[model samples]
Target chain A: MRCQQVRRAWLEPELSAKARRHMQACPACQREWELNRRLNEAFSGWEVERPLPAEWDRRLQQRIATARTGWRGWLESWRWRPHPQPLRLAAGALLLLLVAGAGLYVRPRWFSPRAVKPASTGIVRDLQALNQNQEILQCPLFAGHGAGDLANGAENMN
Target chain B: MVIEDRLTGRLKLSADVLDADAEQMLRFQAGDETAFEILVQRYRRPLSGYMDRMLQNSPVSDELTQEAFLRVYLSRRRYRPTARFSTWLYRIATRLALNYLRDHRHERRQLSLDQPSPVTERPPEAASPAPGQEGEMLADERCRRIRRSVAALPERQRTAVILHKYQEMDYRAIGETLQISVNATKSLLFRAYETLRRELRDLEEAR
Candidate 1:
C-alpha cells in the first residue's frame, strides 16, 4: 500500500492486512499509530466531573411533563432557543420573501399597480396614530430637536 | 433483534445491543416508560461526557444532556426505527452541541475539563508508558497538550475527532451522526488528526 492509502486506513476500526504490513515499516505511520494510541488512552482515562443540583432529575421530569401538555409546553420551550440564529434569520427572510413574492405575483393579476390607492397603507395608519399622540406632540424636547422632521417623515410615508 | 427499514425492507445489521436499543426505543414509543429509562441509564453518562468535551462546559453539558433526552422523549412518536438508536441519539447530541456552540460563539466557555483525577483506576498495563511520579507528570503534561490541541481544532473537525477518538465510533456511525458520507468522515478525521499531529509533534518526539 502506498503511504496515502496507509494513512487513510490507519484510523479505521480494523486495518487491512496490506495497510497493517505497511504501517510496521513506515516511520510516519508509526508516529500516527503511537499518537492514536496515546489519544485513546488519555480519552479513556479522562473524566469530566460536572456536578448538577440534586433536583436535576425532578426538574427534567417536570420539564418533560410540562412539554407534553398544552400552552405551558410552548412557554417551557421558549425558555431555551436551541435553534441557530442564522437558520431562524433565514427562515424569517424566506417567509418575508415568500410574502413579498406572492404579493408581487398576485398584485398584477388582482389589481393594477396604478389603480390601487396608497391611502390604506399601514404607515398611513401609523402616521394618523402618531398625528394623534398627544404627549409626543406636547413634549418640549420633541419640538426642540427636529421632531418635526420625524413627523414630516411619517407624514411622507403616509 | 433485526430491524428492517420500512422504506427499503433491508436488514439493518447493527450490533445486538444497538438492535436492543432500537427495540427499547420502540417500546418507549409504545408507552413503556421503563424502556425509555433503560435508554437513559445507558446513554446519560456517555452523552454527558460527549457534550462536556464538545462544549467544554460541564454544567451546561449536563443540563443539555438532559435536554437532549427530553428532546428524544418529546419526539418519541415521530422517531422511526430506521437507524440505530445510538446513531440517532448521537445525531441529536451533535446537533445540540453545535447549536450551543453557535448560540454562545461570542461567550467564552467555562471549562471544567482536565480536572485532577486518578488515572490509575484501571489495572496497570504491562506496556504502560508511565509508572512512577515522573511518568505521571509526563502523562499529565501529555494529556493537557492533547486536550488543548483537540480544543483548538475547528468546530466540525473537533467534533469528528472527538467522535472518532473518544467515542470510538466507527466511520459509518460517525458519518450518520454528522450527516456526512463515510468518505467525508474519513477526510474530516484525516484533516483533524493532521492538525493534531502538527500541534503535538513535540510530545510525539518526546515519546
Candidate 2:
C-alpha cells in the first residue's frame, strides 16, 4: 500500500491486518504511524486557558436589556396595547357619518320620481283635437257620422 | 400572586422532569424570561471556548457567542422540542462563526490590533529554563506550534478539527451542524488530521 493510504488507515479506529503488516515492513509507514500517534496524543492532552471576562454578566445583561427595548419589545407592546372606549366611539361615529353621507348623495340619483304620461290620456287628447278639427273627420270611415258618432266610435275603440 | 407562584412551581417541576435544556427553552417560549438566562449561563463557557478555538480571537468569540444567545432569545417563539438543544445551539453558533469568517476574512487581521503585543517579555516558565524545565518549555513551544498549525488550516478543515477534537462531537452531530453528510464529515476530519500531522511532524521528531 502507498504510505499515504497506510497513514490514513492508521488514523482510523481499527487498522486492517494488511495495513499492520505494511507498517511493520515499511519504515516510512511506521514513521507515519508514530506521527499520527503523537498527534493524537497531543490533541488529547491539549489544554486551553479560558477565563471568563470580568464584565461578562454585565455585558450580557445590557445586551438582553437592549434586545427587550428594541423592535421586538415594540412589536409585543403594540400587540397588547389596550383599545380605549373613546377611540371605539369615535370610529363608530365616523362610520355612521360615512353611511349617511353616501345615502344622501345617492338617494336622488337612484330613487327620484319620473315625469310619466299615461297611454290612455295621450289617446284621449289626440281624439279631442281630431273632433275639434272637422276636416280630419271627413275621411270615408266617418263619412256619415257626426261628431257625436265619432265620439261614440272613439269611446267604443277605447 | 399566589396563582403566579403555583404556576411557577409547576413549571419548575416540569422543567426538572424533562431534558434540562429543552425544558428551559420551553419555559422561555411560555414567557418565562428567567429561563433564558439559565440557558445562557449553561452554554456561555463552552460556546465561547468553541468560538475562540474556531476564530483564534477571544474578543470576536465573545461577541459571536453573545450574538448566538441573542438569536436564540429572538427565536424562542419558533423553537420546537424535537431535537437536542445543544445541537440546535451549536448549529446557530457554527453558522454565525462561518458567516463571520467568510465576510471578515480580511477584517480578521484587525481583530488583534487592539491587544498588547506579546513580544516584550517572556514569562518565567519560558525564560532561563532549569535542567528539568527544558522539557516543559519544549512542550509549551510544541503546543504553541501545534496551535499555529491548526490555525493555518483551511477554514473547513479547521472547523472539522475543532468540532471533532475540541468539541468531542460525533461525526453525525458534526455533519448535522455543518449541513453535510456523515461520510463528508469523516473525510473533512481525515484531511484535517493529515494536514495537522504534516505540519507538526517536526515537533514529533524533536522529541
Candidate 3:
C-alpha cells in the first residue's frame, strides 16, 4: 500500500476504503483492530463507586479557609506599614533626630542667658564688697585729721 | 429557612457563579478566595478519578490530583478561557501527571496479586442477566486480569484510553484535555486499545 494512502486512512479511519481492505488482508492490522475494540469495551466499564475520602474534603476546606485569612491579614498589616520607601522613612526619621540633637547642643553656646547671668552677678558682688572695705579704711583716716584740726582750733582759741 | 435549604441555597448560588467560568476565574484572579474553593470543589473528584485511572496507584493519584488543583488555583491569574473551563482544568491535571510520570521513570511497584484471589468483585456496569448469579469467582478473576493489563499499558496510551473510554470524552475533548491534535488523540486511543486487547486475549477468548 502507498504510504500516503496508509497515512490518509490512518487519519480518517472511517473514510478509508483501502484501510478496511488492508485490515482484512493484514493479520497484524486485524489483531490491532480487535485489540482496540476489546480495550475500549474493557475500559469503558472501568467504574469505581467509591466516595471521595472525607479527610480530603476537610483538608481542602481548611486550606482554602487558611489561605483566605492569610491573604486578608497580610493586606491589613501592609496597610499599617509605612508607605513607599521604608529606607527613605528611616532616613528622614534619623535626619530629624540629628537636627534636634544639634540644636540642643548649640543652644547653650549661642543663647544661654542663665549661664551669663550667674557670672555677672558674682563679679558685681565682689566689686561692691571691695568698695565697702576701702570706704571704711578711708573714713577712719579722714575723721582723725578733722578731729585734730578742731582740737587745734580750740587750743588756739584758749 | 431550614439549615439544609440555606446550605443548598448557598451551594446552588455558588455553582451558578462558578458555572460562569471566565467570570469566576476572573474573580479568582482578583483575589476572591471563595472563587478558588468553588473551582477546586467542582473539579477535585472528577480530576482525581482521571488521575487514579492514569496513575493506577491510589496515593500517587490523590497527591497529583491535589497538586493539579493547587496549580490551577495558583495560576488562575493566567487563565484566558481560550477553551472550555474543563479542558483547561484537565490540561493542568494532564501536565502534572505527565511530569510526575516522567520524573519517576522507574516502574510503579504495585501490590502483587500473588496470593489467593480475594472475593470476586464485579464491576458495577456488568449487570449479569441474573443479578444473583453475577458475582462469581470467574468474573472477579477477569476483573483482576483486566486491571493488571490496563496498568501495564504505556502511560500515554493508558491515559488516552481512559479519557476516551472511561471519561466518555469525544476525540476533540480528549485532544483538548491532552493538548494534542484530534488525530493524535484517536491514534493514542487506537494504540492503547490494541495493546490491551493483545494483553487480555486469553480472557476474551475464554469468555
Candidate 4:
C-alpha cells in the first residue's frame, strides 16, 4: 500500500506523510523518486533556446496590413463589424428566403409545359413524318413503285 | 472629478492584471490594434516551444506558430470571452501540430537513424570528470534513449503527457484542448506516464 501511494505521488506530486516516510525508507520508492525527478529535468532541458527571427514581427505586421487592404480584408472587416445580433439573424433569414423563393420561382419556368411544348411538338412532327414515310414504303402499291410513282402517291395523299 | 478619473484608471489597471489576455482579446475585437501586439508578445515563446516539441522540427515549429497566430488574428471577429484565451490559443496550436503529425506520419517513420534526436539541440554545459568520460558518454546515451522512448509514445498519450507535464495544463484544460472529457484526460496522462516509467526503468536501474 505504501509503495502504491509512492507511485501515485510520483504522478500527482501530492505526497502524504506516510508516503514520504515510505519513500525515505524504501530503496525502491527512493529510486522511483529519483526517476521522476530525472524525467522532469529531461522535460525542462527540452526548452527552446533559439529566439524567433528578428523579422517575424515586421513580417506579421506587413501580412496583416496587406490582408486589411485586400478583398479578404474587406470580407473579414464586414464579418467582424458589430451589428445587433437579432438584426443580423433576421437579415440572414431574409436573404435565405429570397434565395429559396428565387430558386422555386425559376424552377417551374425551366420545366413548364409552355417551355416544353415547342420542342416536344417538333419532335412529334418529325416522328409522325417518319412514320408516314415508313407506312408508304411498306404499302403494297408503293412497294415496287419508282420514285416518280411514290412522289405522285405522296402528292395525292397530301 | 480628478478622484473619479484616478479611480477609473486604477480599476482599468486592476482588470488588466487580473485578466490581461482576455482583456486584450476584447480590446482587439473592439478594433484596438495594439492590443494584438501584446497578445503576440505574450504567447509567442510558449506557443513556439509547444510546436517545436510536438513537431520535432524548429523551422516547421516556427512556421506553424506564425500560422497559429495569424489564424488568431484572422479570426479575431469570431473571438468570444467564453474560455480562457490561453486555452483557445493552445487548442489552435495543438490542432495544427496534430494535423501536421497525421499528414507526415509516413515521412517521419522513414527518418534516418543518423539524424540527431529532436528534443534538444545543445548539450548540457557541465564539464565531465577526466576519469569519468566513459560514464558521461553512457549518461548521454541514456538521455538519447529516454528521448526516443518519449518520441515513440502513441500520439494521444504523447500529446497528453506534453500538455500535462510540459505545458503545465490542468486535466480540465488539457481535456478542453484535446476535446476529451476530464476523466479521459487523466486516464491518458496515467497511461502515458506508465509507458514512460516502463521505458526509462532500465536507466533508473543502471543508476
Candidate 5:
C-alpha cells in the first residue's frame, strides 16, 4: 500500500488490489500512474507513427538469398570486399583446415580402402579349404562322386 | 505428454511457458526454410518496433532489424533451444542496438572533437522528429522529450524500460534476455521509472 510499493509494482502486468486501493487515495501515486501511462503512450505512438521503409523486406530477402550458406555463402560474405579483413580471412582458412583434418581423421567405412588379402594369405587359404569341406559335407552329390566330379557338376558356379 | 501448443507467434509469458519458437527453430535447423520464413514474418514488425525505440526509430533501425534476422539465419545450424526463441532474439537485437548506439556515439564524439562535422549540418542520428500539423507537432514534441529522457538513461535502464513498457516482457523474460536476475530486473525497472519521474517532472507539471 505504500507509495514505494505502487511505484515498484507499476511495471507489473496487473496491480495488486492493495496497491490499487492506496493509489486511489494518494495524490502522488496518481501522478506516478499518470506519468507511467503517458510514457507508455508516447513510446507506443512513436512506434506506430514511424513505419519502416517499404523496401526493407526486399533488401532483407536479398541479403538472405545471397547469404544462403555453403561455398557461395562464403564467397558472398567476402565477395565485395575490395579490402578484406585479413584476420577474419585467416580465421576462416584455419577453420576450414581443422574441419578437413577432422574429416580425414574420422573417415567413414565407405570412404576407407578395401584391404587386398594377397589372394593366398595362409589364413585365407585355410578359411577357403574349411568352406569347401563344409559345402562338401552338406552336399548329397559328394556321397557318390569325387570332389572334382562335384565341382564339374556344380560348374564351379560359372 | 511433453505438451505441445500452437505458438500463434505470441509469447507464452508463464513460469512454465512453452515456446513454439524452439519448435520452429528446431525445424529451421533441420533445413525447413519455411520455419525460418515464419519466424521472420512473426518477428519483423515487433523487432523493427523494438529497434525503433532503441535506435530512435530510423532507417538504420530497420537495417539493424534485418541484420538481427540475418544473424539468426546464419546461426540456424547452431541453434539450441536453451532459452525461449524470443528471448534469444531480443538478446541479439539488444546487442545490435547497443553496439550501434555505442559506435555512433563514438563517431559523433569524434566528429565533435573535429571542426563542425563534415557529414552534415546536423547528423541524422541526432535529427528530431519532422515538422507537422499543430496538434501533431505538439504530440511529436512530447514524444521527442520522452525519447530524450529515456535516451539519457544508462544503457541497461533504458533497455529494461523499453523491453518492459514497449515489448510488454515480463520480469523473468526481461531478466533472461538481459542475463540478470528477476530481482535485479525488478529493481532496475523501479529505478528507471524513478529516473523518468525526476527527468520528465516538467511534462507532468505542464499536464
Candidate 6:
C-alpha cells in the first residue's frame, strides 16, 4: 500500500496486519511510517503545563449560584402570576354559586301557584279602585252644582 | 456487606462514578446545592486541561471552563442521563472554547510561555548528506517540526487532531461533542491528518 493509504488506515488497528506486510516490501512507505510515528510521539509530548488559576472554583461557584438564582427567580415569577388552574377553579365556583342563587330566587316565578294568583288579584283590585274613583268623580256630590244634573244623568251614566 | 467494603467498591468501580455523576446531575436538577459542588470538584482539572488545549490560552481557558460549568449548572433541569456526565460537560466546554476562539479571532496568537523554552532559538533542520546517527538526529528534528506544523493547522483540524490523539475519544463521542455527523467527524480527522502530513513534508524530507 502507498504511504497515504497506510496513514489513513493506521487509525483502525484492524488494518495494522495488512499495513505491516505492505510496509516490509515498500521502502518509501516505511520511511513515511517512521516519520508519521515520530511526529505523533512529538506532538503528544507537547504537554500543556499550566494549572487552573486559584480563584476559578470560587468564580465558577458564584456563577452557578447566579444561574441558580436566576432560574428560581423565573419560576417564582410564574408562581406569583395568577395561575390559570386556581383562577379558573375560583371563577367557575363563583359562576356556579351565582347560578344556583338565581335559580332559588326565581323558583317562585316559575313554580309558585300563589304567586300567579296574587299578581292577578293585585291587578284586579287596582282596576276596581280605578273604576270606583271614576264613579265618585262622576257623582255630583264630588264637585259643584251638578247634583241635579247627576240624578238626571245617573240613569244614562250606566 | 460492610459499609467500608461498600464504599471501597463504589470508589473502585469506574462505572459507579459514571452512575454517581448521573445521580449528582439529577440531584442538582432537584435543587441540591452540594451536588453542584461535587460535580465541580470532580471535573475541574480534566476539564481545565481539555479547555486549555481547546482554547490554547490558560487564563481564557480558565475563565471559559468556569463559564461552562456555570452553564451546566444553569441547565441542570435540562440534563438527561442518557450519556455520561463527563461527556456532556466536555461537550459544553468544547463549544464554549470554540466560541471563545471565534470571538477572539482578531487577537494576535499569544503563547503564554512562562519562561524561556529549552530550545529557544534552534534553527530549522536541513536535509543532510551524512548517514546513520544523522538519521536519528534528523528524525528528532522532524518530530519537533511536525508538532509545530500540526499546531499551525486551522482550528477545526487542530481540535479534531487533539481530540483524536490526546483525548482518545472515539469518532462517535467526538461527533456528539462537535455536533456533527460521525462520518463528518472521521472526515475532519482525515483532513487534519492529510494537512499534517503535507505540512510536515520538511520533516519527511529530513528523514
How much is A129 displaced in model 5, in angstroms? 87
Q: State the iRMSD of every prediction, in order shown.
A: 5.5, 5.4, 7.0, 3.0, 6.8, 5.7
Error of 2 at B147 (Å): 0.8
Model 4 residue runs over 4 Å out of place are: A1-9, A16-31, A69-94, A113-158, B1-18, B122-129, B132-139, B203-207
**lDDT (Cα, tens digit) per residue for candidate 3, span A1-158:** 74334434643536467676776677766665565555545554556545567788676556545654687434533343323367757876899999999999998988866534445588899998999866875685555556467689789999
Q: Give chain B TM-scores in order.
A: 0.79, 0.79, 0.73, 0.81, 0.75, 0.71
- Alpha-carbon DockQ of candidate 3: 0.08
DockQ of every candidate: 0.15, 0.15, 0.08, 0.26, 0.17, 0.18
Winning candidate number (DockQ): 4
For candidate 2, write residues B89-151 as lDDT tens digits.
Answer: 999999999888899888756645333223211333525987898876766555566666776
Rate residue B107 of model 3 by lDDT. 52
Winning candidate number (TM-score) = 4
RMSD of 3: 19.4
Task: Please state the Cα-based DockQ of model 2 relative to the true two-chain complex.
Answer: 0.15
Clashing pairs in 1: none
Highest-scoring model, lDDT: 4
Model 2 gets an lDDT of 0.74
| Number of the candidate with higher DockQ, 4 or 6 | 4
In candidate 1, stretches whose alpha carbon ends up further than 4 angstroms from where it belongs are A14-25, A49-53, A70-158, B1-18, B109-131, B204-207
Please list the C-alpha lDDT of all candidates, in the order they appear. 0.74, 0.74, 0.64, 0.75, 0.74, 0.69
Consecutive 10-residue window with the lowest summed lDDT within model 5 chain B? B114-123
RMSD of each: 16.4, 13.5, 19.4, 8.0, 20.0, 14.5
How close to the true structure is residue B154 of candidate 1, measured as C-alpha lDDT? 77
Ranking of all candidate structures by their DockQ, best first? 4, 6, 5, 1, 2, 3
TM-score of 5: 0.60
TM-score of each: 0.64, 0.64, 0.55, 0.71, 0.60, 0.61
Return the lDDT, model 4, position B128: 59
Query: Which regions of candidate 5 deviate over 4 angstroms?
Result: A13-26, A49-51, A65-158, B1-18, B107-140, B204-207
